[model samples]
Structure formats: structure tokens, C-alpha cells
Target chain A: MHVLVLGSGQLARMMSLAGAPLNITMSAYDVTTDRVVHPLTQAVIDQTLDQAIAAADVITAEFEHIPHDILAICDKSGKFLPSTDAIKAGGDRRLEKALLDNSGVKNATYYVINNRADFDAAIQHVGIPMVLKSALGGYDGKGQWRLKDSTQVDTIWQEMQECLNGSAQQAIVAEQFVAFDREVSLVGARSASGEVAVYPLAENIHVNGVLSLSTAIDAPELQEQAKQMFTAVANSLDYVGVLAIEFFDVNGELLVNEIAPRVHNSGHWTQQGAEVCQFENHVRAVCGLPLGSTKLVRETAMINILGEDTLPTELLAMEGCHIHWYGKGKRPGRKMGHINVTADYSGELQRKLCEIAGYLDAKAFPAVHEVAQKIRS
Target chain B: MHVLVLGSGQLARMMSLAGAPLNITMSAYDVTTDRVVHPLTQAVIDQTLDQAIAAADVITAEFEHIPHDILAICDKSGKFLPSTDAIKAGGDRRLEKALLDNSGVKNATYYVINNRADFDAAIQHVGIPMVLKSALGGYDGKGQWRLKDSTQVDTIWQEMQECLNGSAQQAIVAEQFVAFDREVSLVGARSASGEVAVYPLAENIHVNGVLSLSTAIDAPELQEQAKQMFTAVANSLDYVGVLAIEFFDVNGELLVNEIAPRVHNSGHWTQQGAEVCQFENHVRAVCGLPLGSTKLVRETAMINILGEDTLPTELLAMEGCHIHWYGKGKRPGRKMGHINVTADYSGELQRKLCEIAGYLDAKAFPAVHEVAQKIRS
Candidate 1:
């Protein structure tokens, strides 16, 4: 079967790699150039976008923010997995919040702020110590503001106003900041047949709102809650592919932080730790194939290598280290690659994580250091 | 660093896939067309052969039978791993035998038959119930004659004469047939820095001389013997890439059958079973990168899908089944692809093997049936 992916990034490249062995040909639509290239396909690249789309049995996106026009075209084909509504819900904070509320899933208390009156109402309802975020086009800590006190509220409001002007639909959501003990995420796949397979909850560490490290947590209660949240959201959205729900573990209570309606970076460790990686499971779900086993074969820790192109040779030489260098040009703050380290036990995994953290720049990889500190304590 | 592979087949494709995450670019030289294409590279296919060769930091072959002229050119560059001499030894039966003998490796008792006198001498020494094989251009049960009785010697001699006419050296090897309990092979990699890592020996089964199934065997004594044989041969050849040595396990004694100087089919299970696959290790060795761990992460069984294109979806739906479909046209007796099934324990692996064997045609996959029977008994 032929699958057309919307983005031509490393995720798409990996999806193609996983699909090739299953006899599933993948072609990526480069949104910038309007050109299509089969990342790991055996067929030579000669087909146009329209030709590829016409030939594809299924269409999916590598990232959540697919252009509306392109998504509309795929939607009309009736072969798009996860549906356009699901992508829209993931793209817009307001829509995602509404879906979570409708599904009876517990999320951080929030209020929508579109204008001065709405902002005043949000401040009155949500109170201080809240995060103000644009409803659309916000990721990796961008388009966000933290309100520490009334003194800082004006400056945060002025900065958020710029986001309102730039956004097509000028709106933002203010969420009450929860003093969470740890951050966690659950990544799972739901098939068209309503079959769901959820991976264990991953304890995540984010530096500057960008995920730095994620290790599969063995907390049974948290895992059960994550599964429930995933099911509620997936069923509500009629999801038919991999979905990730980031949660804040507040004194053992799981509060939804965000949802990614695609394969997530937090689940990268699955490539080495689980029987089937998230990328392959996502492909299988979208292609209408049976979902693979999500059984964890080993304890794994993933460290994201952001912006750095040159890596130390010793990093590759490290035992249990699996480097995944995205073949993209190096740019500051860009996700160039990641390292996955697997071990037989959690202690060994933690030690390996500390060793790898020592190899990376402390400023660039603050999350790794945080995780290492937590493990040491 | 860039690696130029002198064959654009599935082996090269898999090698490219494994090399991508290591930040290594691989360009494949299609000897048939004299064109080069980087299999997993982000770079587009637009460079000429000379340009690719000039740009490559190292050169290697996916298969042993590399053309003499191309091998010579690569040899002149002094960047080719596993020198042309090793490839020559692997290509010709006589040269391989001499190397094995000189290295003091125990191989099948054989006599070189070049002329009528040698053929007569062979019949006297090797006796009846022997196998006569051409020294060149033989693979997958081709260019072979079985002398089950003395009465069939004259007809076999005339048929063998045609192979002599086609061969450059005009030679054949006649070996005394031994009843073997089972077939096994050892696949290992040796780096330029004299670092060697060997995977556990795999018990193999061939149907019509085409490999059908291979499972990683845990017999310590046989595994030790296989590793010693591999080290002896690799050190003698000064090899610097993945090498495979096929062995015949009679009772408990191991007899060398043949050696392949590249990644062999028997090692395909490593993709899912080992910490690092053979292809990845080969790329590491060739690129001067540190070799990865060869630790067996799980028990695995690899079944070759020969001459079939239409596979049942149920085979994929089966738990632990990993399909590797080579994008090649199917022809009778041709290796179309392979299926690798991994399990946590040997009993689970045996059950999975039986389940998969039931799905395959009994006649076309007799080896699978045989294994299933053995496991059942």
C-alpha cells in the first residue's frame, strides 16, 4: 500500500523506513517545494504531488500543523487518518480544551481570553500564577507567557496581544499553573477497528517547554490513568493513529497538560525498549493493519540532541547508546537528533543517562541534567 | 564520512538504513547500470560515478562477486574494507578452500578435480556418495552434481565439462558426503583496528540450497567453536567487514561448509533480535566508527520468503512477526523477502515458528515444516 505523508522531516523518514519492511511504500509531500520524495521507497522519485496523492491508498501527516488547504484535499479523499478535526483540535488549544472537557478528561483549569474583557474575566476566574498561551501556532515554549503576579500581568498581556494580532483567529487560553511533582506522557495507537494499545506512562523532563528526556515509568496507578485519558480522548476524536497525551502528575493525580495527535518525541525510547516502536505502530494503525505489541523489553531513556550537528565519537562508543541523527542541516534550537539508551534495569538506565548527560552541553540539555539529578537523589 | 557500496540490492538498502542514524551517508553503485544512488541519504541522486567515488571516504561491496575492474579501482583508492583478496576467496571455491586449509580450519574433505585424471583420482579417494560442484559462478543449488552411485559418474562428468568450459580456471571440487544432524552458520564483524565482535551461531536450514530458516542457537560449545573458526578465517584474510561462515553440525562436531565475505542471509534475524544488527555493524566497521554491541536481546527465527509476492495479512498480524519485503520482482526460486519473528524465550519462539510455518506452503517451505516437526518432537 502507498502512504503519502504531509511533512518531509525525520519523522516521515523514519516512518518510511519502518513501512518499507512491511511492503508499505511511503512518499513525502514537501510543503515548501510542492515536490514529493519517497524517503525509503524502492520506487524512483518521478511522480508529482497530484499523481502521488491520487495513487496513495492512505494519507497522513508527520506533524500536527498541516496546512489547511493540503489537509482539506486529503480529507476529501476520505483516506486521511486521525481526521482533519483531530488535527485542528491538536493545533488549537481552545478546541483541544473543549474536547478534553467534553470527554470528561481532567485538565488544568483554564479560561479563554480573546479580548480585553475576556482577559479581565480570565484573570478574575483563573487568578494569578497562570500561563497565558495563544490558542494556535504555539510549540516548544513559543507563544506563551507566565503571569507570576499582578505587577508582571501588564507586560505579559502586552506580549500576548502581539500573538492575538498575528493569529488569524485572535484568541488565547490562560491555564492555572499546577504545582506538579513530575511530568508524564502516554503515547498510544488506536486502529480504525477501535482497538487501542497504550504504552506505559513515560516520565518526561522538559527544558524551556521542549522535551529533553523521557523514560518509561513503572507507576501502575499513573499508567492506568494515562490509559484512561488516552482512551477518552481517542474515542472522543475517533482517532485512528498514534496519539500522545502529556500529563502533569500532581501528588499522584494526573492532569492533562497537552495532547499531540501524532507520534511523539517522548516515545522515542520505544524504538529500542519496546517490541514495536511508535513509528511502526502509527504506520500500522493508519494503514489499517493490526497494531503491534507495545511490551517493554528493557528500561529505556531518550535524550534529545537539539541544534548540535557534531557529536562526540565517544557518545556512539557508549554501551546501549542508539543515535538517531536526522539528516537535516544544523540550525540553533533545531532538533538535530536524539540518543536512546536501554538497560536491563532502571538503575542502569539512570546511570547511562547520567553518563550521556555528561557528554552533552549542560546549557543545551538542562532536562538531561535535571533527570540525572532526580535519579541520583 | 560517506560509504560507496558496489551493489544496489537489498543488502545495500538495509546497510544504508542502518547507517543513516550514525550520520553516515551511503551511495550505492549499481554495477548493471554503472549509476550511483544513495539509498538512505538525504542527498538527491544526481552525482556521477567518478564524482561519487571521489567523494566517498570509504568503499565496500554488498556482495562478494564484485567486478574485477571496479574492485581494482576501489583497491587503488586504498579505502576499501575487506580487501579484494577476501572477495576473491569468497567468490571461488578453490581459493576459499586453500585459505581455510592454510588457516588450519577444519572443512569438508574434498579433492580438486581439474582434468579427467583428477576426476578418476577423486572417485578412488572420495568414493561414491559424493557431491561434485563447480568452483565458480555457483549459488543456490546451481552448478552442482550428486554422484549417488558409480554408474552415474560418466553422465555427471559430461555435464560438468560444460561448467569447465564456462569457467576461467576450469576446475571443480568433489567432496565426500557426510550425514549431518543440522546446519549452522556464524556471522561476525572485524574492524580495521582488529576489533572483532561475533554474534551467537545460528542454526540454519536450506531447501534446494536456498536458505529457508535460521535461528540463533544457544549451544555454548558449538558457539565457541564457531567463534574460533570465524576469528581464524577473519584474521587470516585480515577482514574488515561482516563475514559469515556456514557450518555443518554432525552430532556435535562442526565442519566448515562455506564462507561469505559480506552480511549473510542467516544473520537477518539480528535486525530484531540483537542489540545492533549485522548491517549496522558492517557500516560501523567500514566507516571507522566504533562497533556496536552484538548482545542477543531476544531469541529470533528468520524465515526466507522465496518466490512469493502475495503474502497473507494474517502473517503480519501474527504476534512477533517482522516482515522485511525486498522491493524486487518475484521469480521462481528467487529470494523475494524474509520474515523475522522474535520471542522472549525459546519455547515461545518455537510456538511462533510453528504458527508461521502453518501459514506457509508446506512444499515450498519444507525447511520450516522440518523445523516445526523437530520442535514438536
Candidate 2:
């Protein structure tokens, strides 16, 4: 089966790797280049979007931030999986908030702000200590502000207005920021036949708004809550393929922060920790193949290799530590690659994490260093 | 890092897949077409052999049957790994026998035959119950004869004479065939610093001289013996990549049957069962990187998917069962793909093997069926 992913990036490249063994060929549509290419090789194929869609047995997106016109074309092909609405909602916080409300999932109360008056109204509705996020095209802390007090509203609004004015469809989403104990994510796949399989909840740590560390955790209470919310969101959308929902763990109760309508970085640990990796599961779901088991087989953590193209060669000598480079040229703070560290038993993963930290730059990999320090203490 | 593989078959394809994660890009030299190609896509790359060799950081072969002229060219480049002599010995039975003897490893007593006179002399020297195999290009039970008794000598010699007269390089190596209880193979890697890392011995089962099944076994005595032979052979060749030595297990004593200069079929179980897979380890050795651990992480068995392209969808739903297709067209008796079945603990793998046998054809997967039957009864 040939699957045409609607974005040419690391996610598509990983999907290609996972799909190859199952005889599922993966190609990516470079939205910028307007060309179809082999994701892994990045070699351009002489085919238009329509031609690619026609050739594909299934179509899916690697990221939710795809152009609506392109998404519509793929959706019209009747080969796209996980529904076009899910993709749009994932990209737009306004739609995402409505989706959470409609699905009856626990999430932060929010109001959309389009202008100065709307911003004033949002402050009244959502109150102080709110988080302002651009409703469209905002990710990894970009186009965001934290309103801790009334004093910072003017400065925050000036930035928010610039983002809103830049894109006519953009608006500000003011959410009531909950003081959460920790952040966690649930990555699960829903099959065409409504079979849902969720991996263990990954306790996440973000450094400067980008995910830095994600470890598969065994908190039964958090997992049960996350799985329920995952099922609700997935069922409401009638989702096909993998979906990741980031949640704020507020004193053990989960609140949906956002959703990704594709395989996620937090689930990368599944490549070594679980029965089947999320990339393969996503392809299996979209292609109408049965979902492989998502059972966790090992204690594992994944550390994002941001910006740096090179890592300590000693990392290769460490057993159960697998480095995966994305084959992308290095740029400051770019998602260059990741390392998945697996352990045989409980607590061993923590020790491995500490050992891994000794080799990484503390500033570049703050989350790993923090975990190491915390564990050592 | 860029790697140029010698052959554009499934082995090269898998090696490319394995190498990609390490930011190692792989291109293949298609010996038959004399063109460079992407091993996975089989897309022709517009580069001459000399250009590819110059561009490559490392050059290796997926198989040992490469033409000597190409080997000479690559060897001259000072980047081709594991030495050229190891590959030549693997391809020629006469050289392979000498290698085993020179390495001081136990093997079958053999005599080389060039004509009818030599065949008569070989019979007198080696005695009855012998196996006759072509010195060059013999594999998968082809170009072979069994001289079990004096009654079959005349017909066997007639067939041998035609093969000898066909090419000046052709010769039959007559060996004293000792009845062995089972077959096992040791796949290991020798790095540039002469660091050797060997995986657990894989108990292999062959159907019609074609490998059908391999399972990682925990026979300490056999493992120690196999490792000794593996180290001897690899050290003798100064090998710098994965080398597989096949053995005849006669009451736990191992006799080196043959050696493959590249990764072997028996090591396929490592993909799902071991800490670091053989393909990745082979690439690491050739690229001058530290070798990863060769620890068995799961109880697993690999079943060759010979001559079949499609499998039942329910097989995908089976826990711990992973299917790997070579993305090749179906051909009669071709090694199209394989299924790696992993289990959490001891005895679970045998039960899963039986379950897998239920979904496979008895004739197509006779080795799996035999193991299942043996385990059950």
C-alpha cells in the first residue's frame, strides 16, 4: 500500500521507516515545494498532488498545521484518514476548544479574542493568570503570551494584535491557566472498526515550550483518566489513525491542553518501549490494517535532540540507548533528532536518564539535566 | 555519513533502512545493471561507480557474491570494510575450507575435484556419505550432490563433469558429511579496534537447504563454543562488519559449516529480539562506530515468508508478531519476507510459534510447522 503524507518533515520520514517493513510505501507532499517526494530520501518524484492522491491507497498528514486548501483536496480524494475536521481543529485553538466542549472532555475554559474589545471581554470571562495563544499557526511557544496580572495586558495585547492582524483568520485564545502538578500525553490509535489501543501515558517535560523529555510512566490513575479522555475525543471525531492529546495533570485530574491529529514526539518512546511504534500504528490504522498491540514492554524515555547535529560517540556505546537522526541540516533549536533510552525494569530508566544527562549540554537539554539532578538528589 | 552497498537486493534494502536512523545515507550499486540506485525504492541514481565510491564514507557489501573486479576497485578506495578476502572465501567453498582450517576451527573433511579422475580420487580419500558442492556460486541447495553410496557415484560424476566443463573456474568440493543433530549459526561483528560483539547463538532450521526459521537460544556451552569459532574466523579475516558462521551441532560439539561475510538470514530475529540489530551493528562496525550491545531482550523466532506476498490481516492483530515484507514481487520459492514473533519470557515463544503456524501454509513454511508440531507433541 502506498500512503501519501501531507507534510515533508521528520514525522513523515519516521512513518516511511515504520511502514517499509510492512510493504507500505510512504511518500510525502512537500507543501512548500508543491512536489511529491520520497520522505526518507527527500528525492522529488515527478507527480502532482492530484496524481499522488490518485496513486495513494490512503492519505494522512504528518502535522496538523497543513494548508486548508491542500487538506480539502486530500479530503475530497476520499482516501484521507482521521477526518479533515480533526486536522482543522488541531490547527485552530478556537475549533479545538469547541471540540473539547462538544466532546464533553475536561479542558481549560477559554474565550476567543479577535480585537481590543474582545481581549477586554476575555479578561473578564477567563479572569487573570490566563494564557493567550494564537488561534492559528502557533506551536512550540510561538505567538504566545502569559497574562499573570492586569499590568502586562497592554504589552501582551500589542503582540497579540500583530499576530491577529498578520493573518485575517487568526484570533487569540485566552485560557484559564491551571496550576498543574505535571504534564502528560496520551498517544493512541483508533482503527476503522473503532478499535482503540492506547500506549502508557508519557509524563512530559517541556523546555522553553518545546518537548525535551517524555518517559513512559506507570501511574494507573493518570493513565485511566487520560485513556478515557482519549477515547472521548477519538470517538467524537470518529478518528482513524494515531492521535496524541497533551494534558495538564492538575492534582491527578487531567485537563486537555491540546491535540495533535497525527503521530507525536511524546510517543516516540514507543519505538523501543511498546509492542509497536506509533508511526507503524498510524499507518496500520489509515491503511485499514489491524492495529498492533500498544503494550509497554520496557521502561523507556525519549530525549529530544534539538539543534545539535552531533552527539557524544559514547552514547552509542550505551546499551538500550538508541539514537535516531532525522537527516535534517542543523538549525538553532531545530528538531534535529531524538534518543530513545530503554531499561529492563522499573527505576532503571531513571538511572539511564541520569547517565544520559552527563553527556548532553545542560543548557540545550535542560529537561534531561533537571531529571538527572532531581533523581540524583 | 554516506554508505555504498555492493548489491541492490533485500539485504541492502534492510541495511539502508537500518543505517538511515544514524544519519547514514545509503546508496546501492546494482551489479547486474551497473547503475547506482536507492536500495529501498530501486530508483536509479545518476552516478558512476567511481563517483559513488569517492562520495562514500564507507563501502560494504550486503552479500558475498560480488564480482572480483568491483571488489578490487572498492578495495583500492581504502573505504571498503571487512576486507576483500573474507568475501571471496565466503563465495568459494575451496577457500572457505582453507579459511576454517587456517583459523584452526573444526569443520568437515573435504577434497576439491576438477575432473572425473579427481572425483574418483576424492571418493577414495573422503570415503562414502559425502556432500559435493560447487566451489563457486553454490547456495540454497543448488549446484550440489549427495554421494551417500557407491551405487550413485556414476550418475553424480556425470552431473559433476558437465558443471566442471561449463566454466574453467568451476570445481566440486567433496566433503565427508557427518550426521549432525541440529544446525545453529553465530552472527557477530568485529569493529576497527578489533572489539568483537556476538549475539546469542540462533538455532536454525532449513527446508530444502533454504533457511526457514531461526530462534535465539540460551545454550551457554554451545554459545561459548560458537563465540570462540566466530572470534577465530573474524580475527583471521580481520573482519570489520557482521560475519555469520554456520555450524553443524553434533552432540553439542560445533563444526564450522560455512561463513557469510555479511549479515546472515539466521540473525533476522535480532530485529525484534536483540538490543541492537545485526544490520545496525554491521553498519556501525564498517563506519568505525562503537558496537552496540548484542543482548537478547526477548524470546523470539523468525519465520521466513517464502514465495508469499500477502498474509492474513489477523496476523497483524497478533500480539508480539511483527511482519516484514521485502517489498518484492512474488516468485516461486523466493525469500520474499519474514515474520518475527517475540514473547515476553521463556516457553512463551514456542507457544506463539505454534499459533503462527496455524496461519501459515505447511508446505510454504514447513520449518515453522515442524517446530510447532515438535513443541506441541
Candidate 3:
């Protein structure tokens, strides 16, 4: 089977690797290029866009932000997975909130706004300490406004008016903030056959609302609840392929926070922890194959290597730490790669996390040479 | 780094995959094609043999049976891993035994022979109930003859003579048979800098001496012993890539059975169980990157899917079971694929194993339908 991926990136590259042995050929288009290459090759396959699309048996995306024109072509082919509707729901906060309400998936209260009057009314309804998100193309805390005080209301209203252009209308959401203990995400896949396989709930740690680390465990109650929520959402959208649902754990309440309608960064540990990786499962689901397992092999912690941090050779020298470099040119706050450290012992897992974090942060471990130097002093 | 591979097979394919992300390119030359393609691609990258070698930074084989001409080219490059010297020891039983004896690694006593008379004398010297093996190009119970009684020796001698052809003498090993409890293998990777990482010892089961299943677990004592032996052999050969040592558990003694200079089939579980797979480690070692963690994630059992059996969908439907199908046209006794199953609970692991094995073997479980049929009967 031939699969065409809408975006060409690491996820598409990984999907190509996973699909190769199954005799499922993957060709991905970099919307920027007319030349289509096998994801792993980064070499030219088809010189024309139409030929590449004609060659594909199925069409899917590595992420939700696929260009509307490309998605329209796929929709016309009647072979696109997770559907354009599902993707739009995931991409726009307003659509996502509406879908959640209609699907009966519990979520934080939200109000959509188009102009200053609507924004003012939303502020009145939701009050201060609310999250105002652009309805489109917002991620990792980008294009977001947080109202922390009433003094900022006038500035926010002006900003909203400017954002709306001359029509005094622009789509956005003002959501009531839920004070949560922790953030978790359920990365799950559903096939066209309505078969759903949910990976273990990943406890995510975010630095400035960007995912930094995700750890997986057998938290039975949490897993079961997350599984139910994921399944219900997948079924409601008639979703085919992988979906990641981020949840705000307010005490025991799992308030729906967001959704990623593609294989997510949070599920990266499944590459080593499970028999089948989330990327592979997404390919299988999108290609209409039976879903593979979503079981965790060990407690695994995945740390994002943001920017050009000097690698800690000492960390690689340690047991149970696996490093993956993306080979991308690095910039500040850019995702260069990640390291997955897995172990049976939670204490060891914690130590590994601290060690990697220290290395990436360039914070020297004080327990060894420093201790000796201090003793001599 | 540029890596030249001797054999163009799946192991080579995987090595290429591991190398790609690191910007370490691999070129594999199939004896038939002679055209070097990017290993991940079986597409031609270099049409001339000399050009391929000239482009290589390191040369290696995916298997031991590399044709002599290719070995000579790699040998002249002075960059061949597990060196051509070490590979020679692994490819032939006589050389393997000689190396084992010189290195003081434990092994069954053996003597080389060229003819039936030599074999008979060696058997008389070593005693009956012995094993005979051809010196080269044998794997998984091939090119082997087992002698249980003297009465059948003459007929076996005739078959051996035909197998040997007329060099007037072909090499073979005559040794006492090991009465073993179970078989196991240790896979270790060493870098040019003398840094080495050993994956946990894997318990293996072979059906008719062809590996059927393998389970890798963290047994500290066994791991230390295996590490000691592997490190000794690796250091002795100045090996700079993956080395797999197969062992026989003779009553409590770990007698070395054979050695593979390339990634061995037994280490397939490492794909799911280890922090870094043996293939990735081989790539890292050859590419001059720091070696990855060899820690086992959990107790994992990998089952080879042999022959032309159609895999059942139910097996894939199970949690924690991942199937990897080789894109090969199937035949009886051909390796179609393998399944790696892991679990948090031993009971669940065993149950999954049985459920998957039953599906593959076409044995139905005792379900409500079966119970109802039994009641009717």
C-alpha cells in the first residue's frame, strides 16, 4: 500500500521506516516542494504533485496544520484519514470546544469572540485569569493571550480589535482557567474498523506550556478514564488514525484541554517501550490494518532537547539513557531532539531525568568533583 | 561517516535506518548487483566497486558469509569492524574453535578434519555421540551432521563427502555433543575508543536448532559473566562493532557455541526491550558516536514467524504484541516475520504469548462459544 503524508518531517520519516517492512510505501510532500521524496530518503521520487498524489493509496498528515489546498485535494480523492473535519476541529480551539460539547466530552467552559464587545462580554462572563487563544494556528503558547489582571483588559480589547482587522471580527476562544495539579495526555489510535488502542496515559511536564518531558506508567484509574475519553472522542469524530488528547488534571477531574489529531511528541517513548510505536500504529490505522499494542514496557521518561544544548557524554555513558538527535539546525527554544531514559526503578528514573536535565541546562553535578574540591577547601 | 556493508539484507536495511538520523551514510553492495545503493534504499548509489570503497569511512558485513573479494576490499580499507580477521574466525568452525581455545573462552573440545578418515579418527578420539559441522557458510542447523551411533557413520560419511566436494579436503569440526538445559546469547558492542556496552543475556529456544524464541532479562550474575567473556573476546580481536556470542547451558556451565560478528537474530528482542537496539548500537559504534544504553526495559519474548503461515488479525488485536513482517515472498521454513510481546505482569505476558501463539498455530481458545458447543455435544 502507498501512503502519502501531507507534511514532511521527522514523524513522516519515522512512519516511512515503520511502514517499509510491512511493504507499505510512504511518499510525503513538503508543501514547499513539488518534488516528492520517500520520507526517509529526503531524495526526489516524483517531480510533480499530481503524480505523487495519483500514486498514493491513502493520504494522511504528520500534523494537523496541513495546507487547506492540499487537504482539499485529499478530500476530493476520498482517501484522507482522520478527515478534514476532524483536523479542523483539532486545529481551531472554537471548533474543538464545540465538538467536545456536542460529543458530551467534559471540558472547561469557553466563549468564542469576534470583536471588542464580544471579548468584553467574554471577559465579564469568564472573568480574569482566563486563556484567550486564537482560533487558528496557535500552539506551544504562541498566539495566546492570558488575562491576569483587570488593568490589561483595555489593552487586550484593543489587541483583539486590531487582530479582527476592519470587519471587527476574528475567531478566538476565552476559556476559564482550571487550576490543575498536573497535565496528562492520552495518545491513542483508532482504525476505520472502529478498533481503538490507547497508549498508557503520559504525565507531561511543560516549561512555558511547551512539552518538555513525558513519562508513562500503569496508573489504572487514570488510564481507564483517559481511554474512555479518547475512545469517545475518536468515535464521535469517526476518527481514523492517531489522536492525542491533552487533559488538565484538576484534583481528579480530567478537563479536556486540547487535542492533537496526529502522532504526538508525547507518545515518542512508545517507540522503545512498546512492541509497536505510536507512529507505526498511526500508519497502520490510516492504512486500515489492525491496530498494534499500546502497552508500556517500562517507566519511560522522554526529555526534549531544546535548542543547541551541549550533549552530556556522561549521560550517554550512564545505563538506561537513549539519545535521539533530529539532525535539524538548532535555534533557541527549537526542538533539536529528545532523549528517552527508561528503567524499572522509579528512583533510578528520577535520577536519570535530573542527570539529563542538568546536562542540557549545563548545570554541573556538584556531588562528585565539586564535593572533593569543597572538602579540600 | 560512510559505512560500506557486505550484504544487502534487512539487517543492513536497519543499519542504514540507524545511521540516517546521525548523517552517517551507509552503502550496501549485493554480490549480484555489485551496484552500491543506500542501504535503506536498495537503490544504486555507486555503480563502480572501487568508487564505493573509496567513498567508505568504515566497512562491515550484516552477516559473516561475505564473499572473499568484498572482504579483501574492506580489509584493504583498514576500517572493517570486527575486522576481517575476527570475521574469519566467526565464519568457519575450525577457525572459531582455534580462536576460542587461544582466547580461553569456554567451548567444546574440537578438531578439524578434511575427510571421512579424519572425522572417524577424531570421533574415536573425542568419543561417540558427537557433533560434526562444516567449516564455512552454515547457520541455523545447516551444514551440520550429528553422529549418535557408529552404525550410521558410513552413510553419513558419503553425504559429508558430497557436501565437501573435491578440494580433496574441506574443513569440518568434530566435537563432543553438549547436553545442555537451555541456550542463550549475549550481544555486545565496542567502539574504537574501547568503550563497550553489553545487552542483557537473552534466553533462546531453537526448534530443530533454528531459533524460535528469545527472551532478554536482567540477570545480574549471568550478565556479569557474559559481559566478562564478551569483553575478553572483543578486546582480543580489537572489535569495533556488535558481537553476538551464543552459549550452551551445559548443566550449569556456559559453553560458547558460536560467535556472530554482525547483529545476531537472537537480539531482535532488543528492538523493543533495550534502550537502544543492537542494530542502532552497531551503527553508533561504526559511526564513532557514543554507544547507547543496553538496559532491558522489561522481560520480553520475541517469536519468529516462520514459513508461509497467514498471520491472524486477532494476534495483532492483542495488547503489547507488535508484529514486524519482512516484505519477503514466503515459503516453508522462510522467516516471514517476528513478534515481540512484553507485559508488566508475568501472568499477562504468558497469557498474551499463549493467545498469540494459539492464533498463529490455529488453535481456538475455550470461550463462551466453545463452552456452548461442548454443552450441546
lDDT per model, in order?
0.87, 0.94, 0.78
Could you tell me which residue pairs clash in candidate 3? none
lDDT for each residue of candidate 3 in A6-27, tens digit (9 for 90 to 100): 8778788878877875667788
Residue by residue across B194-293, what tens digits does model 3's lDDT show?
9989998988877766887787765677677778888888888888899999988776578899999989889888876677788889988877778888
The best candidate by DockQ is 2
Comparing 2 with 3 on DockQ, the higher-scoring candidate is 2
lDDT of 2 by residue, A1-377 (tens): 99999999999999999999999998999998899999999999999999999999999999988899999999899999889999999999999999999999999989999999999999999999999999999999888899999999999888888898998998999999899999999999999999999999999999889999999999999899899999999999999999999999998899999999999999999999999999999999999999999999999999999999999999999999999999999999999999999999868888888989999999889999999999999
lDDT of 1 by residue, B1-377 (tens): 78999888889888987887887878888888778876543234677777878989999988877678888888888888888989988878889899999889998888999887999999898888998888877878888899999899889989988888886675899988878998999999999888899998998888888899999989999989888999999999999999999999999999899999998899999999989999999999988888888989899999998888867778877878889987777898788889999998999999998888888898777888998988889
DockQ-best of 1 and 2: 2
* Best first by DockQ, ranked: 2, 1, 3
What would the TM-scores of all predictions be?
0.97, 0.99, 0.87
The TM-score that candidate 2 achieves is 0.99
> How far off is residue A50 in model 3, in Å?
3.7
Expressed as tens digits, the lDDT of each residue in A1-377 for candidate 1 is: 88998888888888887887877878888887777876543234677767878999999988877678888888988889888989988888999999999999999889999877888899899988899888888899988888889899778778888888886685899999889999999999999999999988898888888888888879998899889989999999899999999999999999999999989999998989888899999999999999988889899988898998887888877778999988878898899988899998988888888888788888888888877777778
Give interface RMSD for all predictions. Answer: 1.5, 0.5, 2.7
lDDT of 1 at B97: 90
For candidate 3, the TM-score of chain A alone relative to the native chain A: 0.91
- Extract clashing residue pairs from model 2: none
